[model samples]
Structures are given as C-alpha cells and as structure tokens.
Target: MSDQNVAARTRAALDAGEGILRLAPTWVPRSFLMPGARLKLSREDLYALGTHRGGIDERWFSSTTPAANEGAPPDEGLSYVVHDGAKFTLRDAVGAHADELIGPALNAKYKRWPVYSKFFDNLGPIPHHMHQSQEQAEKIGLEGKPESYYFPPQLNWTGNNFPYTFMGLEPGTTKEQVRRCLEDWNKGDNGILDLSKAYRLKPGTGWLVPPDVLHAPGSLVTYEPQWGSDVFGMYQSLVEGRRVPWELLVKDVPKEYHQDLDYLVEQLDWEQNVDPEFKANHYLEPIVRTGSEQEGFVDKWIVYGTVAGKQVFSACELTVLPGRSVTIKDPGAYGLVVVQGSGHIGKLDVDSPNFIRFGEVTKDEVFVTHKRAGEGVTFKNTGSEPFVSLRYFGPDAHSDLPKVGDYLKVG
Candidate 1:
C-alpha cells in the first residue's frame, strides 16, 4: 500500500475504536524466513502462548537485609527478628525460575542489560522533587549551576507525588527513545517534570509505572522495579541557578510516541490528599486488593494501606516495639526499608556488623533483604521508641490468584 493509503486506513481504524496494529510471535528462528518478512498475530494468541510457553518467572522484592547477629554480650536495648510474616527472596522465589515467568523472546531482550534493584528512600518529612535547590541536589549527587550548558535541576516530591521511572523491555524505536531519555535525565541537571501533573501516594502504597508514562511518587517513601533501562523526558526545570528553555526541551520530545502525554496529564488527581483518615501529617491512602486468584501466583493492591493476596509483588508496613521482632516464613527475595525510628534485623548481637540499624531513615539509604525458600528472617526495634519498616516481595510470593476489583482505576 502507498503511504497515503496507509495513513487513511490508520485514521479510519482509529476513529472506529479499532486499528490494524500487528502483534508478533514471542519466538522466531532467525534463519527460518527471508529478511524483512512480517508475521502478524493477535493479542489473544500472544497471551495464550505466553501462558503456556516456558518462560522465566521473573520477580522482584525490596527491603532491608538484616545483619547476622553472632552471640555477643546481649545489649540491654538490642533488637531482633521475629517469625510471624511471609519471608522470601527474589533470587529463590523468582530469579531461579525467571524462565517460567518471562518467555524466551522477552528474556532475550532483557539479556542485553544487567538487572539491579531500585529503592528510593524519603527519610525526611518530605519526599524528593525533580526540581529543587542545588543544596538538595548536591546531597543526592546531582549538583551543577543552571546555565545554557545544561538542563535545570528537577525536584521530585515523593511525599505528595507518585514519581515513576520506566524500562523499555521490548524492541521498538519508541522503547529505545524512552530508554535514552531516562539516561540523559539521570546524567544532566534538568530532569523530566510535569508541573500540570502530580500524584498523591499514601504512605506505603506503590504501583507499577509502565513505559511511556509521566509519573512520580508523591511525598512518602517508594520502591520501583522496571526492565532495567533508563529513558525519560523532562517537562520542567525550576531549580535555582539552572534553567532550560521550554522550546529547546520540547524539541527533543519524542513526538511520535508522545501522543499520550495529554491523556496522562488529564489523569492527574490533584484534589486528593495523602492523609484522609488520621491527624498524622504523613500522607496515607487506602490500597485496594486485586488479582489474588491467578494460577501459580498471588497479587494484591496496596497503593495505600494493607491489602494482601498473591501476585508478582507484595509489600507491607510494620511497627516494631522495643525488643519485639517479626518473622517472615516465605524465604524469598524481599525488601525491608526503614521509614522511621530505629530497628535491627537477623541476629541483634551488638558486635555483628551485618546487624541492621536505623538512626533516621533517609532517602539516601534504604534496606533490602534476600532470603531463600523455607528460610526466615527477623526484625527487632532496639530504639527507645517504636520502629517502622516497609517490606516488599516479588510476584507470586504469597498467592497465585486474581482479585475482582483489583484493577488500577486511576492513572
């Protein structure tokens, strides 16, 4: 077909709420066909194959890995781990069986990059913003005067915003652009920021940010997992001393793939508050549990509060009292991030260097834990006051069923 004909057909299909987009098979032998040959499939076929194909069951968990406590003289205020909750590690729970979660085609794409854990800490009362002062920038290792030589600094408000980063795990020009954008933002002073948009995250709630979306975690602490690729765009640069022209930044925008930017902007929930149920200044929102009944795994919705089930990822917040400990039994890769107060994990012996300790949980330092199946870890609050921690586990760490009403209603 000619270019004009293709354009007309695309327009007609889009207007009718349908389009002739092509889906490719998950796997293809390189030498099986001629170069540039196209094979079209449907979404249903892809999904069916994905479910049946032997794929890597990839999963991720976030939390503080507690220190091993050796038998040292017991300190009067020593903290310790308890065995009451689920305990698991990504390496054992998901990493070892990644071939079962992600199919061969997708696995090949991921092999191009190294997988690393991503954790964000907001130890202070407020979260980090993409556009903020240089002092804050220096603290986070992003420091430079704003000038024509670089983009302005961007501060991210994790307390009142839902900050998101994306990874393009597929092969496509659009995905490549997204990855490149993130790399540029991370290396420069000015990062992506959308002033007309913001997100409100209740403490302890997190959601996945797919590729090609404008998002940030509002105030409070947050953890993220992605395809291990960096690509993004900076919508605003408001830091002192550094600033870039909007036109210049927009010129670099991936216009072909950015048609959804306006739609994303419209999804912002500006009227919502982080804390709706308590007088505490911390942002708090209710999490909805969804998708807990899928075969082989459990998924829960904890965008704000505690909603448990089976899925690829699970997380919860706990308050440990002095000398109290919580034991996790799942024995898989997990994350233990300290949000407030002080605590210890594993053996609480004072001399054990691996003993987890928290003076003031800051965004710069987040604790992560990795365990094996059937093995357990513990946490104890050794501080004079109560200790708080956030824990995360990989997909299917708990259950393997889907929940009715577990869908993400808002963007």
Candidate 2:
C-alpha cells in the first residue's frame, strides 16, 4: 500500500476508536526454547510455525521491532492493528503517523515506538545469556535491550518444569571461572550456571534487568516490557541437554572479536553482575499507585525503575472490580493486553481468551495513542470477575515514576 493510503487508514483507525486501536495477536517463536503452553494459544498451534522453527512461545504486543530469530518471516514479531475489518501493521501506522500515534516529543526523538512488551512462556529455562549494551550493540549497528519482567497471577496458574530464574553472577564469581566455562563450550554442559544464583519465581512480582547482565529465565509466563531490540549472546553451551551453538554466543559480537574470549567476558557489566545486593536492587514488587483497594479499581506498578538512570520503559497492572469503572490518564502511548475477564476500554471491547488459534485476531490486545492516554480512557468491567490488563509505556513517559528501591517503602 502507498504511504498516503497507510496514513489515511491510520487516521481512520485513530478516529474510529477515538484513539484506541484493536490489535491482532503477534506470536513469536524461539528455536532454542519449549513452549510452556500458558499463553492461551491452542496446543495444536504451538508448533504452527513448524517444529524446526520451534514453538510459538512468545506473544509480542504493539511491537514494531521484528524478532531476531534466524529463518523467521519478515513480519515475525510485528503487530497488526485491526480496524473496520481491515488489518495493517502497527509499524506502518507508526511510520505514517508518528506524531499522532506516539506523541510529537517521542516521534521527534525516536521516530518510532522505542519499546515493546511480550509474554514469553517457556517450559524449562533459557540458556544463560546477556543482551548487548548500547555501546556493544552499536559496534554491530544494532541497539541495546534492557528488559523488565512481571509474572501475572492470572496467566501463571502453573509454574512449569523449573520455577526459578538464575540471574547475574554470584558475588564472588571470577572472570577466569567464566572464561573457563566458555572454553569448555564443546564439552557437554559448560556449567556457566554454577557461578550464578537462582531465585524462586513468584507470580505478581518482577525484576529489572539491565543490558549486559546474564540471566537464565525460569519457566513462568513473564510479562516483559523492554527496549525495542533483540540483540543477545548466550554464554551457556547447553540448556536442558540441548546444545547451544557457538554462533549464538557471538551472535551480536563484532566478527573480529567472535573468538576473543577476553572480549566476550569483557562484554559483561562487572560491577552490576557482581553486586552483592542484586535482589535488593533488581527485584520488584507491585506498589499501589497512592490509592486504596476500597476504590473501584487498583492500579499497581508492576514494572518500574530506570535503565541506566533513564526511564527507558515502565508498566502497570490495572484491575477493575466487577461492575465498576475507572478512567485513567497516562503521560504517553502504551500497548495493552487483557489478561482476565472482559471489559470495554474506551470504544474497544477487551476480553481474555481461553484459547487462540493460529493466524487469528483477538480482542485481548489494543494500543492507546498518546493523545488518548493523556486525555484519559475509561474502562468498564462488564463481567463477574475482576477485569485485569497490563499496559507498558515507552521511554520518559512519566515525569515522576517509582524508583528501583521504592517498593521497600510500600508498607
């Protein structure tokens, strides 16, 4: 379609829903991981993209950033906006109407939506890996990824194989130990995880992970709000008896430094990785947004805190009581996903589905334009259960937000 046509359609979508756009579910696969099957996708459709391509283990929300998986389609991780029985990519909508969609300040700066959220469900655990820092990724002309995780109780009814995540290096871990693990890559089980500590996964909790920090996420349905980049390097040689190719360890490294053990080890943020207060600094608990539960709804900050001292991204879990309604005003644009019950968000009907088929559109996802968010959107719960949804905002969305250690003061 022409750029003019996209712009026209984008405008129509914004107007039709009063700045709220319903989005189609965007499923993403990972060749290295097994699906936990808690994403509401039908079991038969887990391998809908083919077993070789891995299972549909992730569902991205309001994303423009494509998945970095090898052998994936061009639109693998991009979301589609459904309006008037027509569908168009959210990427193109942002491209054609950036100012109207994301706000003039963010559009002028990033020129695109700078962040995306996803539900990544795995059966066991991911390989110990680290996303490149901006300095490291820029060497390959790519961007960094700083992500935060929130496990929602509604989706995490069952914690699969392993309900614990290994994050960062132990306080006294040495670089030589890590280097030795890398050298033993060809051997079965490189034992990189031995140098780390695992925390029991808990639903209704979260963690802020900086770029270049190693992590092996456990089996739980995770709601992640992250920077719009997919650059990472796996340090573990094997995961759950599955071999992790050497190429994956150097996937985002410069070609010249691919085999440089020192360079690979240097990629880690030593100070942060070895911080003794890792959990105290990175772990997050929901903080009520200066309100009481007696109100009609509860708004909690599920994912907050800065990345590199900047408000890179943030998220909130809003739960409207049955038969109640609330109007919320945010500072910027956000992508939303309904996780429980059914409700009316502005003009769009939102519902959490029991099962979603491959290539099917769902009412559970939507995007609220910056203008609409600032003006306020009313949510009405029409179901007997609590209506729950998650909304993630882009960088610098709020002038004042909860800090990393703020949850400690909650009580």
Error of 1 at 96 (Å): 13
| Residue-level lDDT tens digits of model 2 in 91-208 | 9999988887899999999999989999999999999999999999999999999999999999999999999999999999999999999999998899999999999999999999
lDDT of each: 0.29, 0.94
User: What is the per-residue lDDT of model 1 for residues 91-197, given as tens digits with 9 covering 90 to 100?
Assistant: 22223333332223223443211222233332221111222123323333432111000000111232322223221122222323333433454344433332123
All candidates: CA RMSD (Å): 22.6, 0.8
TM-score of each: 0.36, 0.99
Best by TM-score: 2
Stretches of candidate 2 off by over 4 Å are: none
